[model samples]
Target: MKQEYEALFTPWKIGNLEIKNRIVLAPMGGTCIFGWMEPGGSHFDKEAARLLLKIAKHDCGLIIPGIAPVKDMLGGKWLYQNKRKFAELAEFMDELHATGAKMFVQMTAGFGRSFALTAPLAMLAKNKALNTLAKPYIDAEYLTAAPSVLPNRWADDVTTRAITEKEIKDIIYAFGETARLCKEAGVDGVEVHAVHEGYLLDQFTLKYTNKRTDDYGGSFENRYRFAAEIVKEIKDKCGDDFPVSLRYSVRSMTKAFQYGAMPGEDFEEIGRDMEESERAAKFLQDAGYDMLNCDNGTYDAWYWAHPPQYMPQNCNLEDVEHIKKFVDIPVVCAGKMEPDVGAKAVKEGGIDAMAVGRQFLADPKWVSKIKKGREEEIRPCICCHSACFNLTKHNGTANDQDLTESAGMCKCAVNPRSMQSKKYRVKPTDKPKRVAIIGGGVGGMEAARILALRGHEAEIYEKTSELGGVFIAAAAPEFKEKDKQLIAWQKHQLKKLGVKIHYNYEVKPDSLPSADEYIIATGAEANRIPIPGAADYAMDATDYLLGRKQVGKDVVIIGGGLTGCEIALDLFRKGKNPQIVEMKDDLIAVKNMCLANTSYLRDCFKTNKVPVYLNAGVAEITDKSVKVNLKDGRTVELPADDVIMSVGYHPIPLLQAAKNVHLLGDCKKVGNIRSAIWGAWDIAMKI
Candidate 1:
């Protein structure tokens, strides 16, 4: 093992509890042992529990499940009312302890105004008749309360009223009751979820969000009183010796209400600054919290809390380290944290531990790989947030994900068997058969791996020298280092599984390979616009990414979907001026797109002073200039040293009617990694 990672395995104390290692699995939505953000009765989620148990068996030291909402998001039943479920939790904890992992139940007051309200729920809140009719089952206003009457982070059409003083006390009581129940249920401790992420508790802490004259809102102490009181009540109920960690954001990192400060941007903070964080860290510690599970961000600065590939590694490390000085409690930082860099941070005593989230979703055996000196074998989290926290937004909708999908959050984009252990798992196939998968993209590789694991001969036919289809271009950007790592990991896995690889071999539709099954994964081609002189003047998006074409200083990229936006960002980073012309109202305004990734890209364009024309289209392409129709009614000619086409793609399934032939990845339909990978897994398991 690396000397730097030694600190990670060292024992650490949280109050009276002795944790065997400094590694922590930070909480994420839908992976909660006690049910995720589901809209129903609060109970033990066996699916989520099974996922955590697998992680525990992988040798994790401390595992914190996702938020156990103090007030149920669905039926408004207080969590304490579900006391019967605590018995199941006790038994689950017993099993976790056998693996030498201490579990912490993360209890939350609520999302309040920061809640990712879907369109249907927003409509329900707007209509008095509908709200009254749905009152027994759901209450939109109660679920979306605020510290003060404020504009909701999700919808501009709706405003959330201030949470009543009586309601605050009730929630505090709920916290104490929940903590007491957790201790009795054999849990090691409880972590408050949090005066962070600009949630209900956090709204009270931030001056901009809290404009109340009540005892719980004015001044620093009053603003903090709600959280402090919750801590005191929990300690009183669970015993003062019982450990309690606070999930804290060291700095809000917001430029203003509904705005975020870009990383390294020296903007005046409109939310909690570092100076206030230092004082608050001490105050929270003094109030009897044992440790600080820290990061940086608010709902406004979503990227910092839920970082994407665009954000740098260990983005919140400096701010967290600074906060550690003001308090004696152990501090852990989590924000796109790299294992090696985080281990270095731990070794230097900058932070006590590293709290990893999405990586655990990608690979449960991540820590075991590190401990066994097999760091290269660990699957990297690309931080796409496509399957995990994909709370999408676009024109005419606050959130695009359906309610059912919203409930089953935190599924991995790359790893299909994350929370879906019940559905997708490798149980040795009764009938082993030869499988030939065309194309070497992510989906093809995934299908090959699964088939190989199931005692089948799986062979991949790649036209290029290497695997990774369109994903090769996707991972080419400097910011996509992890995506590159993921590609390498996939290739390594395929080789280890003994899957046959025939490089530079493209199977033709006419001469199909002799196999039990054929999987078509020949990815889509970039759609070129049909403008005049486009063939001579405009370059394909994939060609530009593969470095086949070099554009001059000024580049205009057509299409503002995720691909085009990412390409534009790459172009800008490489000392080139890039302008984006999109037919959509916003960049990457499509479903299943995580807000964290999209917001970071959006912020980058604004921060770097890049030009983006939305709801616009290209009219014609010239040698050194291009004509465009703006969102309004104006048509203008803009200088374009080069034009990259990224409009969209069409499926290119080679043998759609062939017997026993399956279509996967882009060849079937142009979709993101999730659809491709999951689609491959779904078919592979059946065959």
Candidate 2:
């Protein structure tokens, strides 16, 4: 290991529980032994256990699974009601200890208004009769309760009511019992699921979210009393020696209720600022919490808590380091933290430990890789929230993610076998054959790499001179460094696996290759609408992204989808005035787009004063101006120095007549990197 990284390998302590190293596998939803957000009885999640064990085997120092709710998501019973689950956890912990890793069960009070309200819950909330009938299984309204009445982040229509004092008391008692149960289960410690990310506990602590005259609201002490009581109660039940950590936010960085202050942007903090965080940090320690797993941002500023590639690396470090001075307890900083940066911070006593999240999903063996001085082999997490935690809101609907995607949270976009190990693991093929992949894009490359790993001779034929098809353009944005790195990693892996590459060579239907199997990953073509003067006045998204074309200062972008929004934001960042026109009610109208990602872009647009015209359509384009049909039935003429079209794409597959031919990626259908890569893995494994 590098000398700077040596600090991360050193032992650390939270109260009396000594961790093997300063590396903490930060909690993530669906990674807990207890079922997460699933409408089922609290029990040992074998799948979660399997995954956690795999990570543990990779030499992780400390493992904190996803925050397990005190109250069941489905059943009316509290977490303590499931006694058998504790026994199972004890057994899992015993084996986990054998791998030299200490485990902490992160227990949450609840999501409150922060709950990603799905379609079924929305139905239950609207239909009172159905809600009452479903009470034994799921309390829709109760599940959606907040510290005070507030607009739901997922949807404006559903405002969550205030959580009653009685309910708060019940949860406090539950935390105590939950800690006791965790101790009985031989877990190393318990971490409070948080006064962070604007969850139930955080809602009470933040003045903007909590508004009441009761003991749990109004004053700073009152606002924090709920969380304070939880740790105190846990200590009373589990003893002071029993370690208790708190998931904390060093800075909320919220400028408004649903607006985030982007990194390095000077703005008034609407939520908890640094001064308050300093006091709160000391106060939380005084309240009996042993450690602070720190980060910045709330649900309003979701990107900070769950940063995309756009956010800065070690984004929360400086703030977390500043907060560390206020408390003596170990402070771990999360949020796009770099290993070397974290090591330097730890070595200099800026922070005690490094808490990482999605990187573990991308590569569970990352810790082991670093330990073996094979850091380059560690698969990088691009921080795309596609397969994991796709809490999307669209068309005035809360939680627009599909039911299956919603159930399966904390997945990785690049690693298809992350959560589905049993189903997707590579096996030795009895028969090896030559495979032809007709595209050097991410999907085609992924297919080729996996096929080669499975003992097949895989060769990629690229029509272009380089690998990474549309992904090259997708990674063109300056903020997309991680995406570019991912492409580099894939290329490195393909070369390492000795996969043959045929560049600048396109295979046609008439010119057939003598391979056992063929995969067409020709990707997609930009969809063009029949608007007047489109050919003359507009630049396709692909052409612009590929740097083949440039736009003028005043740009009117057509479409408000992810691609269009991204283009607009990219252009705006580059000192171009880009206006968006969309027929949708919201910015990102598509489902399964994570709130963490979309919220950042939306907040960025708002913060930077980028003009967005929703519920509008482009009528026509001219040399001097672009005509837009506004929702109010007014035909407004926007200055048309340039027009960028990013409506969407259509599949373009080739060589489909071959007997063993297959299709994947955008060529199969318009989808994301998760779908494309996973599709490649699924088909490659079958062959």
Candidate 3:
């Protein structure tokens, strides 16, 4: 192991329990061992269990599987009532213990107003009779009940009614009963999922969300009584030695409803502040919580908790370190934590452990790689919540995500076999054959790698000298360092796998190479909109990103999609003034994009004073200015030294159809990295 990471390998203790190392597998949403959002009664989710066990076997010290709701979403049965699942878990625990890893089941009180409401769920919430009929199957009302009546995070029409005191008491009792079952099942401990992330229990703690005069809300102690009582109940049911970790938010970086404060932005916090967090940290610790697994932000400021690439490394470290001073119990910092930074923090006693979540989904063997001093071989998580946890919401859409993705969270965009082992496994082919993959983008490279792994001779043919295709331009920004790393990782994997590459050789459909099968990954071309003088005055998004075109101080971006907004932010950071014009009502109003990723860019633009023109279209581009048509039917000329068009892309395949020929990636359908990689895997496995 490297010298810097030595501290991370050292032993750490959470209460009386000793963990072999300081790396903790943080809980995500859908990796729950007891199942999540399913229609039937709670049962042991073997898929999730298999994923967690793999991580444990790979040398993770402490494994905390995703949030297991104390009450089942369907049928609303208490978790303790599912005794069969506990028995299964007990047997699984014995197997996990053989790997020398401790296990903690994260139990959630529920998602109160923070419940991500879908369109159907919003309808069920608004119509009383519909909700009554759906109660047995979904219980949308019970799922969304909060400390006080508040608008749902994802839906404007859906309101979460104030939860009754009886429900609160029932939930507290459920925590005790569940903890007891976990203890009897031979589980090491249980982590409350939490008085954090603006969930049901967290709603009771925040003054803005909790307006009740009942015993659960009012003074600081009253506001925190819900959390304090949970730990106390767990201690009473299980022994005091049974370690309980609290998934804590050191500070809530929220500004208003559905708005978040950008990192380092000056704003008055509407959620929990630092002063209250310090006191609450000590209070919750004194109330029998053995450890504090800490981060920041609520559902309103979701980016701080579920940070994307734009967030700085160790984004939650400073606050977590500060909170550690207030509590004697062990502290684990999560949220984009770098391994080296975490090691330094652990060595200096800044934090006891480093909690990592999404990275494990990207590479389950990351810990083993680190210990073996082969960190470069480990795949890096680019933090694109494209496939995993992409519960999207915008100005007018409610949870605009595919229902399949909503149910199956924690699947990595880069690694297909993380949560989906059965679907995307590497098996030896019965017959090995030479395969040719056109284009050297991520999709083509992934196909070649998988084909080679399955005992096939695969080669890539690229038109350019480099391998990453348009992704090279996409990773040009400083904030997108992880994207660049991904490109490098793919190149390295292809080289190590001995996949032959023919660069600077573009193959025409008539001049195809001799191969048993062919994969067409020619990618897409940028859409050029017809506008007066645009052909002469405007450049494509890739031109600016690739440094082929330069923009002056006053720049106008023709689209407010993810690419345009990112370009605007990149320009602004580089000391250039950039303005955005979009026909949509909101920026990045696309489906399958996580709110955490989009909210960060939106908040950054707002904080940096980047001018945005929404519901507007660019009519024409002049040499020094661009004419825009506003939503109010007014034409305005904006000062623009240069114009960059980011209207989107269209696939341009070299070969449409042929026997033994398949298309993948943007050439087949223009989607994100998840689609490209998964599509490649599906085709590669078949071949």
In model 3, which runs have C-alpha deviations exceeding 4 angstroms? Answer: none
lDDT of 2 by residue, 1-687 (tens): 677689999998888788899999999987877985566767788888888999999988999999788988877689998899899899898999999999999999988778788777877776789999999888988988998888877766778888888998999999999999999889999999898988889988888888888998889999999999999999999999999999998888998877899889999987899889989999999999999999989988999999987788989999999999999899999989888999999999999999998999999999888888987787888888898778887657888889888677877889977778888888879899899999999999999989988999999999989999999988899988888889998999998999999998989988967898988899999998999989898989888899898778999889888888889889988999999888888898888898889988888888888888889888889998889888899999988798889888999999563569889888888898998899999889988
Please give the CA lDDT of all the candidate structures: 0.88, 0.88, 0.92
Per-model TM-score, in order, reads: 0.98, 0.97, 0.99
Clashing pairs for predicted structure model 1, backbone only = none
Alpha-carbon lDDT of model 3: 0.92
- lDDT for model 1 comes to 0.88
Per-prediction count of colliding residue pairs?
Answer: 0, 0, 0
lDDT of 3 by residue, 1-687 (tens): 999999999998888899999999999988989886666957899999999999999999999999989999878889999899999999999999999999999999999999998899989988889999988788888899999999899998888899998988899999999999999999999999888888888898998899989898889999999999999999999989999999999999999988888888889998899999999999999899999999999998999999998899999999999999998999999999999999999999999999999999999999999999997798889999997799998789899998888888999999999889999998899999899999999999999999999999999999999998888888899999989999989999998999999999989878999999999999999998999989999999999999998889999999999899889989988999999999999999988899999988888888778999999988889999999999999999999999999999999888884778899999988998998899989999999
Local accuracy of candidate 1 as per-residue lDDT tens digits, 202-266: 88999999999989888999999999999999989989899999999989989865678888898
Error of 2 at 450 (Å): 1.2
User: Which residue runs of candidate 1 sit more than 4 Å off their true CA positions?
Assistant: 36-39, 657-659
| Cand. 2 Cα-lDDT | 0.88
